[model samples]
Target chain A: MTTTLGRPGTRPSAARLGLYRAAIELKTFFRERDAVVFTFALPAVILALLGAIFDGVYPGSDVTSAEYLAPSMIAAGIASTTFVNLGTGIATDRDDGTLRRLRGAPMPPSAYVIGKILMALVVTVGETLLLLGIAVVAFDVRLPTDPARWFTFGWVFLLGTTACALAGIAASSLAGSARSAGAVMHLPYLVLAFVSGVFFTPVGALPGPLITLGSLFPLKWMAQGFRSVFLPDSILPQEVVPSWEHGRIALVLAAWCIGGMLLCLTTFRWHGRRGR
Target chain B: MTDTPAVRVRGLRKTYGDTLAVDGVDLDVAAGEVVALLGPNGAGKTSTIEILEGHRDRDAGEVRVLGHDPARAGLDWRTGIGIVTQDGADLTELTVREAVRHFARYYPEPRDPDDAIELVGLTGKADARVRTLSGGQRRRLDVAIGVVGRPRLLFLDEPTTGFDPQARRQFWALIRRLAADEGCTILLSTHYLEEAEALADRVAVIVDGRIVAAGTPATLGGRATARTLVRWADGRQETDDPAALVASLTRRYGGVVPGLTISRPSLEDVYLDLIGDPS
Candidate 1:
């Protein structure tokens, strides 16, 4: 047998490998019906339910309850798709030996991370569209006509999803097993949604400390940024600060993205907690 | 560099807190050779293999795989090694072909995914989802993924642990085909004495993190040179010269020794003795 020694420049480029990883990631993700329903449909269901329960428009604004909720739920949907989905999904991978198998292969770790984020991006987009459709058709919420609002929607979606996805990757390492990951990821997400005024109308109505606490995380700023895009400026006085803090929202989400990346780098484990 | 052993280790040691898992150990596997690490549970077989695979860090060791220290080896080195771990990846949603093809992309030069599936006798199951495969078929899929990269060295960590008798034999045949066709160096770990004897060119018996004996199946623990038992209908005797004892017994019977038998120790006996297991 001939030995082939030191074959240089033979590995597929990292970007190409990442795309392959993403392809597999998406394929497997969509096949799991439970995951699709839980990750993609749960937020939309919550929005529909909330839209039905809350009937009145805000005290001084023409924006109905459903219209106010439609945008914030989109933000929550992003968190669900990226943060909760990735946290549990990565934990499941670690638990089920997928990460171990990948680690054993010649594929770069960065490719695996990129694949997961890309899968989240695809799922988040689908989820956002579903929620928007439900909001507009079922609850009579209006789509944004202005190009500037759409532009705000794009950057907020991108930054918010990136930040939450990174946080999910970082948090995946905290779960001891796949069974516990749902709890570990959802507890913080639900709490943040409440304190961020995702379930409530008018962010100013939330307790001062709760709002302050929510501001420290990405979800609150993400919800606020989305509200700026969908809700009319007349509704701006209902905000805690009475103005759209677009710059602060971008800074916070961007910072979380960087911070979350660092956390993932420091904490990511390719194996289960007791694997070694 | 071509002459360097596919795997070489000296003074390999690892510990978990205060408990030493792998103590001072030395092993070598030449290219194209098949070596089995035979040990019972908790005997450091996994620790040593994982260390060699670069999946686990060693507390102290000088180890080289494919002519490079696994600890510092890059992707090039990784591409030359394939690992079939005990627990296969959960690719339940993917068809066997898809899983094999997915892994094939990781390597620069990979076997055709269909051919790899054929090599592992999984062509019929190629289109089936991984979750639908039987235990034996799932393990075969793991082998397909491992070999798709065309690795120069393959590490199989107890590949047939839970296989039935027929499945075990089939898996052994698959492994033998790989050794013959691919000429790849294989380092397998297993606790089954029969499995080690069947698949290994050389068997190394590990006990409590140390190699107690290492040799071919017939000669392990000096079994080849050990006293043989010569038995007849009336009596039995253990002697160094079994042939001479049998001749004497035949002559005493004046033609043939009734119910006569001559045998050396079986590999199981030698292994049991080597591991200090009375049972």
Candidate 2:
């Protein structure tokens, strides 16, 4: 019964711990057929539906309907996975006691958070690629030819998804139960998306208050950022600032990332039973 | 490990709003010992266990687990301890083997995942999805994850809450194996007296946020020295000397004592008395 494993100071580095956790989280997420289907498939379905009804209706700027909505759809896809999915996933884990058990493990708390964010990023990447594939093949939207535009797409996609993922994790703590996670997360996202014109292109008849309200959320800027990468330069006038506000978009989304990370660090609840 | 106690606590107290959950409780568990915290529901057993497992904050206490304060302990300190709490472990999506291997990577010196799963009698179901397993099987998986790190200490809170009779016995054997084979100190909390008697070298009884009794099962609350019950077919007498009473009963029965029975107060009786229950 004698042994020598009681050296309490021995542990792997935090990065190694986080990598393993991320692998496990992604494995589980990929295996859940329903989660994968809803996360990627639903967005593609909505795009197809939009492409069909708005056939030949170019929002008066010679912009094909599919080309007009491609970046917005992609932005919406990233938002759903990063915000709605991760938020509810975390809240469900809390309600079911998964976070408490993981908190008790030897791994660092940040490792768990990193693992979840990584999973959201993985889902976001897969869904974006799928939507873009559909847009190129089925909707006649041209894939970016220049490597420079591809680079813009990469950073915008990364920053947008990372910021939204952080928001999801931060907001998850406010949800009281798994059942409420979806609604709690979707309230702000849906409101912003509605005003930002995600479901429909608000062409020629832009209102003032909705534009201001949309400006307050990161999604408005994220969609514009992605459009800067995917759409033609002439389409910039449809945006609030009429041109690629690339620096502002990066700054605003980066702020959300910082703010969301702070919120998650300060307020995320590993134990759901704890009182406010 | 030899000189230091596996766990030590004094004047431990915790409160929730206006209610005191654990008030002035002291306890010690030596290394390699399996000490069971025995108490009924709402008796603060879970709260005490949670605090020791470092998942809950204590209001006041001088507590050390393996010579480290759990409240301020770091990952290295946590690596020496294993826990099977009921939450944030919705590993139901993974197979038993996958979950075990996943958790194993979190530890610096983890036991082979296969060995851990087999120890809990789940080797045959290693490929089974955790959600498909029965209640007892899930508990066994919990134990596998709890011990995968070859931890210096283990905290099992109501580990066998939903286990059947056979599963409970198997779980006890597994726990005994951990203490005997691995020299792992165990702090098992449960309301089942039989489980405490079967698994623990010492039992601590907590009731209404206070420890009313703590000792070995045979001597808990003076159970071993309590008055013995001497009985015949139709006669009964409560006496300290059962041998003398048996001798007199034999003589009255003319060399044979019919229906003769001699029994001391059971641990349950002493426990009931200590908790101030009339029955």
Candidate 3:
């Protein structure tokens, strides 16, 4: 056989392999109906449940509960796409030896991770749009008039989901099994959502440390970005309006993305240690 | 002919923390010559294969595959080799053709997907989902993917581990055809002694992270010309010249030697000895 490097043969390209990896991920994700229910349906269900329960009850004002719940529910939907879907998916692939199989292939390792992150972003954007559609048609929620806020909503959701998915990938490597991945992946979402005022009125209404601590994570800033678009300007204290300082949110998320990328590069196990 | 060997591994050493997985091993496979790496479990076969496949690194050694050091070889060098592992991914939802075509896109001069399927005797099952195929059929599909890109050098790591007896014979024929017809250099690692005898032009016996012996199956462990053991109803004898012994016995018996038989060590016997079985 000709051992020459540049013989007349088709060699593996990173771009083509990336497309194949992305297709495999989508097919696997959709083929499992239970995964579909949790990743796609569950987030929508949570959004609708929150919208229904809170559409009419506030302390003194006549604001509908759906108006209060919309932003936070959207934030929760983003959380599901990034953390819950990604963490469990990567862990299961590792368990099943799928990741190990890809290692020998010509597929670039970074492409595989980036493909999953892109899938998570697609799911989050789809879920957010679905929640907005429900808010407009079912609860008489007003659409934001400023197009710049819409741009902010799009950028925040994309960046925030990217950050969260990176965290999920990093967290998935921490667990030894898929079951543990699910457990660990869910804990961060629950704690961060509650503290970030994702399901509540505002962190200002909560304890001072709660708001300060919430600032440490990406969820609070993401939710704040969402609320900035829909909430009336008077409702937010001047200090909390999505200000130039909010750029720090992007910086924090970028740091997490870089940090998570490093952790996954270092510790991701493609196969079982036992070689089964 | 001063070009580097197709694969030259010299004193390759690797330790997993405290355990020495591959300890000071040396090997070479000339271009276009099929060499079988034969060993039992924990004999460092997998570690050696991983290092050669460029999936794992060695602690200290000089190693080369297709003229470039695998440890530092970049994307272009990696594309020249193909590896078929023991098991493939669960591609239950995709038809055989789709899966092959998807992998084909990764390579620059990939053989036609249909041709690859035909080469593996899976043309009839091209549209079938991989999960629907039987064990032997799926194994053939795995082989198809490995050669789809027409790799210069191929690595088959326990390629037929789960094949049934009939399937194994057929797979052997396919491997021989690939070597003779396509001129593809093959490195097949297997536990089956018969497989080594049937397909490999040369077999290397690796034991405890070292290559103990390497030669044609007949000559391995000097079995080709070793003393033959002859047993009769009344007596048994061992002789280096079995033909002369049989002739003398026939002359004394005036026609036929009762219970006449001549036996030499089988490949398995030689392999066991080479591997140094305590039992």
Candidate 4:
């Protein structure tokens, strides 16, 4: 009866609990290799492919099409990691009984959720690195040098990731099964990526109504933040247009985060049907 | 209220839309005692256990576990309790040790994960991923996680429902040790009457949301000293005292009567009768 499965002597501290849950969440995410490929890896590959294909498409445009596409991929990466990755992960966890097991434990609900967000953050970082690496080495895309702009990039990335992740958690509650979650992610992701300028220019280039519609989502604002960092300052002719108003972006992101969390808190079903 | 039973329940009721899942019920289990709740499928055994576990809210009743109403008890109260549910929905990404250690972090005073695994006889599988373990091994791991916190009261809802015979016996032995050595109060719900007979100090037969009979396995449904059926090669007769009948038969036949046997209703028989399912 002597087993090596002994627990640590003390209950893990809140900090330690967060770390452990994060580590486990990462492992669970990686364990589903197919999901990993579809959610994070596929986006990076698509970005690279499109960059290579459109290397010289719109010559003498204020920026090369590839340079324009690179910044947009940052927004795409955020959307992939936060909403799609999170929704599917939560749905699968619910379907698989992992959430119920966690519920039975004495862990705080906030800690459980924090762990999930942390995992999503890890994936977000990886996606950002992939897109940034491609932009730097393959496309000769210049790194933003202004300290102010770099600071703006950091804030935008964090807020964008949080907002998307929260929205994903909310969507997870609506999904009936893990497979459906994955399937449903496809349409929203493709349409939003295209319309939000993750694969093209912003609202001005698209139809007027489409511009208004695309600006409503977090993806458009996220791309604008990246453009503010990478785009030439002179192109933004109008002074103080609030094109990348960090405060407003933060507020909107916060609203989405709170709204998504409330929806998930209200509707997510951990205990699956008994027959299942 | 201070002298309340470890578990005191009265008029417990629950409904799922139109269906009355758990009708009015009453029962109690004292401190440091193990009680088994027994019934067939759809007999409201699980619904009642869920209500007691505080996982599901009740429609109406006074229910308490360890002096506090489970429905209203906060985290402080949940810490003192353990539960081993029927389903094992682990993500299977961590080693056995890692999973147990991770959950141990939640409790205020958890037992050593190693000790918990050892208690359930899964020491060898500690380093193995949960996905690699056999069904019985995974079940033991579930039990390990349930007890890692050294809970004062444990709720095991069909803990052995899917276990094979040998594994079921092993789990029962583990439960006995938990009760005797750790002095943990246990409420086990099972469809298997044999399991109740083996592990419970007292068994409560629940049917249609109410407890139909509650007593020691020997006296359930008047099982103790009930008519003993004596059977011989030529005939069979019911008697109050089988020993006296045997003695008289031995004298008449000068000892070693032909195929003479005494039989009493088994726990299953009595349980079936109590639950209104004699088949």
Candidate 1 docks with a DockQ of 0.55
The candidate that achieves the highest DockQ relative to the unseen native structure: 1
Write one digit per residue (lDDT tens) for candidate 1, span B17-51. 89999999899999899999999999999999998
lDDT of 2 by residue, B190-234 (tens): 989999999999999999999999999989998888899888888
Cα lDDT tens digits for candidate 3, B1-279: 225477899999988878887888888888788899899988888889888888787899998898888777765665677787776656667789988887777667788999999998999999998889998888788788878878778888877788889999888888898899888888889888888889888898888888888889889878888889997666889999888888888898888788987899888888988888776
Q: Distance from true position, residue A266, model 1, in Å? A: 2.0
Candidate 3 lDDT over residue span A18-37, tens digit each:
66677777776777776678
Order of quality (DockQ): 1, 2, 3, 4
Q: If you superpose only chain B onto the true chain B, what TM-score does each candidate give? A: 0.97, 0.95, 0.93, 0.93
Please count the clashing residue pairs in each candidate, in the order shown. 0, 6, 13, 8
Candidate 2 i-RMS: 4.6
How much does candidate 2 score in TM-score? 0.94
Ranking by TM-score: 1, 2, 4, 3
**What is candidate 4's lDDT per residue for A1-276, written digit by digit as tens?**
111111334445656677778988888788777778988788789878888877553433366667777877888888998899888888888887788777667666677788888899998998898889988888877898789889989988977887888788877876777668888776787888877767765334676666667767788778777877876654343212425566776777777777876877787666655421
| DockQ metric, candidate 4 | 0.33
Q: What is the lDDT of residue B41 in candidate 3?
A: 80
> What are the lDDT figures for the candidates, one per model?
0.91, 0.83, 0.77, 0.80
Task: Say which docking band candidate 4 falls in.
Answer: acceptable
**CA RMSD per model (angstroms):** 1.8, 2.5, 3.4, 4.7
In angstroms, the error of model 2 at A45 is 1.9
Candidate 4 residue pairs in backbone clash: A3-B123, A5-B113, A5-B114, A6-B113, A6-B114, A7-B112, A7-B113, A7-B114
Candidate 1 lDDT over residue span A183-238, tens digit each: 99989989998999998876788989998998999999999999998888889878
Of candidates 3 and 1, the better by lDDT: 1
Regions of model 4 farther than 4 Å from truth: A1-16, A57-59, A200-205, A233-258, A261-276, B1-4
Task: Compute each candidate's TM-score over C-alphas.
Answer: 0.97, 0.94, 0.89, 0.89
